[model samples]
Target: MTLRHTRPEARPAWRKSSYSHNDGDCVETAPVRASVAIRDSKDLSVGTLAVPHDAWTYMVDALKG
Candidate 1:
């Protein structure tokens, strides 16, 4: 499966991680079809990291372990 990379926009509503603290070091995510859009909550204009749904699930599972 080919993963397409697209520029992140402000149209999608991004939500910050629940584990994030008030220190300003938080990650935000936006659901985009079968993919997920991630970016730093502090500076959204910088860019975003897009990952496939399965890949994102694997990452979260690994992080939990």
Candidate 2:
């Protein structure tokens, strides 16, 4: 199952994805609690999708392999 939530008033250090482009297709991520927060780089007010650290790590590793 996945968790869904919104960004808090005090935001963390969000970083855009390396695969992002100037055409507005990009994602920003930040580490929060035991999960990683993800949001659209073009719009901060949209909300965030936070996923577990293990899920994030596994996805990243799979992408690299």
Model number with the top TM-score: 1
In order of listing, the candidates' clash counts read: 0, 0
Q: For residues 1-65, write the lDDT of model 1, one tens digit per residue.
A: 22245666635677889999999899988787778889887875778888999999999999999
Which residue runs of candidate 2 sit more than 4 Å off their true CA positions? 1-10
The digit string of per-residue lDDT tens for model 2 on 1-65 reads 23344666555777888889989889988887888988886775777788999999999999999
Each model's C-alpha lDDT? 0.80, 0.80
Deviation from native of the Cα of residue 28 in model 1, angstroms: 0.4
Pairs that collide, model 1: none
True lDDT of residue 29, candidate 1: 89
